[model samples]
Target: METPTAPGPDVPRRSLISGSAAMAAAGGLVLGAGAATAAAAAMAPNGASGVVQGARNGDERHPFYGEHQAGISTPPQDHLVFTAFDVTATTPVELQLVLAKWSAAMAELTNGRPVGKVQPARANGVPGDTGEAADMGPHGLTLTLGFGPSLFDGRFGLEKFKPAGFDQLPAMAGESLDPAMTGGDLCIQACANDPQVAYHAVRNLARMARTSVRTRWTVLGFGRASAGANQITPRNLLGFKDGTRNIKTEEDFAEHVWVGDEAGQGWMAGGSYLVARKIHMMIETWDEDPINDQQGIFGRTKQAGAPLSGTREHDVPDFHAAAPGGGPVIPADSHIALAAHENNGGTKILRRGYNFTDGLDAVGRLDAGLMFLSFQRDPEQFVALQRKLGSSDRLNEYIRHVGSGVYAVPGGLPAAGNYYGKEFFPG
Candidate 1:
């Protein structure tokens, strides 16, 4: 369907919510966001901890130019298609010409190439690469791009660069949230290791911004529930083991995941702050509970995910060990003792979650869950660890958080004609 061009002379005309007036301009660029598997690349030439440098190769790629951004420390990819957009442009320079045509089509769909010319039996020709992931080589895809919070509600003057504690995501506690599956002004996550090459890269960037973006809510995840770099921890849908104390190395992602300069927004210093959520999982009431009450409601070890005060899966959790006709052998309302960043005062994030299903419901059950994702420089470190796991996490009695969002994600793309929020539209 490709037909939305025109925006060349250094990009910036503003007027169409049908208020008419036209005269766009343009430039180019790309990069950033979360991860999952395919190990052997702990990046760090100032790009921070990474992944996807080998294993499961279909030409494992990850490098849309960097210094931060390649799916938030690239490595996690075993499907995920996350979406969220809804910008329908009316200014901010037509949303910066849809981030300069989505940074020249996400630098050719994360280097597997092809943002155009898929002739599709042309009659008058309009294919522009929608041929369902043509050859699909780059299985380690990664596309990122974010910026919600009503895209800074002053409509497009961008409420003074909105990143200092970037809002929206408050009413916590076992959430039921569903305003048509929560908010969005723009987002795109797309990872790969193939689920149709991550749903053909967000379905060709929503069919090349079909007149300035619309699909606000997509999802689609699968497996790789969280684990990166030299991999291994992956199991959610309540089988435990998810991200086992995530935020790995690079000094724990520079003291808890990217975004520095105190996030007062110096172009969001090497950006980071996604937060998605979906969750649901009631899977027949957590498969009829009782496996020692589901390992004391996830204090761990539902088959070696370790930690009832530690035995293996990366050990370390001894939150005051005790339990012999006593009180604390892990269960401080366990979900790893309330998401243990050592009981939250140390606060960490960066999970990169997945695992989902969409099938039955009208009382048939099994709709399945956990999209969750993470990454944080300060989303109050996931709102103080989900307000202490939505008021006491005993794995919240079989999950329910139904869809939410929070983006921002703005670093990396320092070369090739620069685009994508190029510092929030400077001349």
Candidate 2:
């Protein structure tokens, strides 16, 4: 994949990296790259200094710094380790320090290097970097940070920095939200081809910030449930192709996914809002249903994944096509009919969800589900469609909404010495 360039000239590079990492540079926690005149080398980690080069398998890597954060619009990876964190610091500076440390560590990790100075094996001294992913190439790993709604609840003096439309999602129908898994002050989304690579990124990050933050909840997912640019659609636990109409083209991203200056907060201009839902599927029950009923639930053929009115997967659904007898060909309550952008005022969301399975739930039936994740310019795009799904979608009978979160993902760092969310804490 080509390295994504910096955002259009409207967003200044300095403004993107002016805060936490710069603060660390002043205090000596970080090293300086070349002077301003040095040409940009291969992209560094989001907040770390200097170009990171190394040997690897296929050198499958994604640049950490770009116009928008990696892992959002980037093609979906094979595995995911999504984690939310709660800040325990009492002051803004304390929280800033935590973000700074994480930023520097991310730079190294994404560049296929270890965090901090790598030291030789010592008999008594502990190592500064965790050695789990030592030899692993970048593995196409991407770590994207997000600030949850709680982070702006008058904490860290960030209330004024919250986007105008940003807020916790309201309780929609069919939701039995678990308090422990619902809200968080921050979140980090790690996606990579290797499960270990994704896990190592989160494990090391949590270890580094243990003093200032605690993991609120985590989910490990495999077999991406959605497709991105040039990717083929993958199936969800429900045995149906998911995200068949996801936002893909640059035009679609600008229209539906990436946030623009209308965000009412300049810092969030290139950033997007994220919504995650833990949807537990009743696999046993779903498997018992007749194939025709299953097809009706999703409005797509089980084997071919084509719309009810079409013969192929990508064929536009003829929502208005008449059935042989009298009714509409596609049921109004089917998942696709209700969630389709055409039916919802042309609204679209970029989906990067994954299929997940835990051992089992309370009763002994398999505990597996879709970790429903989507990014949009505004959260309401999801809310409006979900409200429709939550209330009337036929598929609701086979799933339960147990956990949820909404976060404001800031724009990407422009270069080294820039931490995520730097624009939020301007001097």
Candidate 3:
């Protein structure tokens, strides 16, 4: 995959990093190439990370940051433990069979081993990634299987592929490998503790993945999955402002976000990621209000990340920090105040997520909302803090939680090579 190299034209700076990486993890967008520049600075600030660093550019006239990522919305509503599979004779098949055996042997719990109740699914037959029938390739088959919640943690007893540290655990079971020599193709995620539910969901996926591998249909590797509940990403709901507060600090940011140094290793550094989220937006209510009201809800102009009372879209808000005792300029309890944390001295995050509209309903209605997603090293400080800040803010009502999940986005495994502990876990 060719890495996107085109830098979007620079735009003026805004008060906060819009949909940043942390926002993405929270279900939000990806960062564009080079969004920061001098020309875009109509009125610069003392410390500007990047223009539209966290933005929602879907609105044409940029209610804020006029030219910054104007009118571009992030792709929304798709998330799975994305990986590319290379089909071959040696690949493992009968994962369901394995599940049946494991289930019979172990408890009904789901974990690394398969659950007992799984069925075979065909890659060439499945509707989602079935692809063009006429375009079969010769090198090796490519199969992409997106495991649902059931397989990993949807179920109660089964929590295979969930996130946790296993001391000295071999990477693989039959032919095990160590982390030093292996980047797992099997991505593990932590769902919201309903292991039983995750079991059923992923069990179905195992059958399909196993069958495809058996049939020499595909070799698996990570692909840029649309961020959702099961994948990790770098963007959010509104398009422009994503991944702004992501720590560029040498140790953590590089270790977590950057491709190789620590997170993935040298071989597969900078490789693509699997992003996922369940962004619950109250469209029924959010869109019902007039445009200005909508703007008020988000604290910035609806289409841009600007203060409700400010001009020049990206101009910094006068948070009434030094306002006269008479009035509230930006509204102390507004979404912007909660979002910007300006009163508390602006805190930010890295956001990468998507915008999706559940199919229109009877009244020509849509579940249009943001599948906000993001990733970062410390979820506590950045992500958790923001949630706490916005807890009682005005925007909470419309956006409520319907689903939530987390995944351990692993680094890549080298192709055609033995993994670490190959000696320990003999294949």
Candidate 4:
């Protein structure tokens, strides 16, 4: 299928309001109390919208437009409702329209407003907004979009526009993938502090794209954030502090996360590659293990999240250090030992994974684990780490990698235009 090429100027390039401005405008409209109100005010400038702005609060309300996408590095939200879609549009124009609509809806949703203004009298037709999140604040919602390698097929004449590193991932060892959960033509990762907010974002976008896309697979996840004033680490379902040593800071992000301009596919510059995996944890088996055994597998103290070689969580692991009796303090086969940057040619990826629970399986065993999401400058970084982890990580015995995908996330929407992936469709 093909679309008649329209004149360049005819395509919609911008939404009604830019993402940042929308947030600023909505900031004054007080949502609720506590973090929600503080977050909203922080997003807007003082007196910008006649609302009394507070000192910057928690990591909420990331701008939708920038050099790089927000969700990848923006503090990981507490909940996630990630969905992958198969583009069913027969024409490029139809696909572009879907993106335009998605961008407009996303702008409003991220600003703590309903997709459409409420008008009871004119609401005779299909509801313009789903209304699930009508009263809830934005909750630091971030909607990140990406294109899978399948999107570059001949369907939209995008074969030649495929980014260099945007290839389907090669199969790794120990993968028992379910076909339904494996791949998709495109993906959107909706993350928010509140689960309902996240779900609402994805649901509305999928609804809007009903004509141009079909849902391939979706995963809902929640995370347990650390308690206390300085909440730095979040625990996974495995009861281990995940992403403790993850790449943070602007310098690290530039070095390890954002794709460089010279890295082939100009459209992908400032963007990053996402590697998603659905790992099923063998809960019954893991639960039977002793505390020491569990700690040994992860190479970290369960209570303090400290490396086996050190007493503090932030202390750099001395991989070469020996225990009192002998042997390495951090076990050779432990998850951290093999997956660490030191072991992988100094490579690192930004982890934004979330713990998930999906009730029980047919056998009545608890079906819960992680939706592993990692972003890197290159897909090779994740591929290399996974290859090592699959072979020797001790935690492998208790986890099974059942679903996977790789996507090339393009740079953020330009300040003037709210459209996404517009560069891929340039005439």
| Best by the TM-score measure | 2
Tens digit per residue, CA lDDT, model 1, 1-427:
1211222111111111001111222322111111000000111111112333475556566767666777876758888889998888676655665676566557556766655556534588556567787765667788888888889988878899897658888989899988888889988888888888778878876766666679978888888788877778888877777886777788888878888888777877888889999989887888888788898887878878888887898888897989997998888998888888777787888889899899888889889898988988878889888988889988788888989998888877765455567567645
lDDT of 3 by residue, 271-349 (tens): 2233233444556666467766655555566445456567544477776644355555666667556555445444433
Q: Which scores higher on lDDT, 1 or 4? A: 4
Alpha carbon lDDT of each predicted model: 0.73, 0.77, 0.31, 0.74
Show where candidate 2 strays beyond 4 Å: 1-58, 117-121
lDDT of 2: 0.77
Task: Give the deviation of candidate 2 from the true structure as CA RMSD.
Answer: 6.4
lDDT order, best first, reads: 2, 4, 1, 3
For residues 1-427, write the lDDT of model 2, one tens digit per residue.
3332222221122222233234433553322222111212222334323232222352467777777888898888889999999998676655766675576567657766665323534566455456788777667788989999899989788888877768899999978899888979999999988888889889888876675689999989987999987778999998898878888899999988898999788768788998999888989999999999999888899999999999999999999999999887888899999999889999889989999988887888898899999999999999999999999999999999988999998887777666665555543
Worst 10 residues of 2 by lDDT: 34-43
Output the worst ten-in-a-row residue range by lDDT, candidate 1: 33-42
Name the best candidate (by lDDT): 2
Query: Backbone collision count in every prediction?
Result: 14, 1, 96, 0
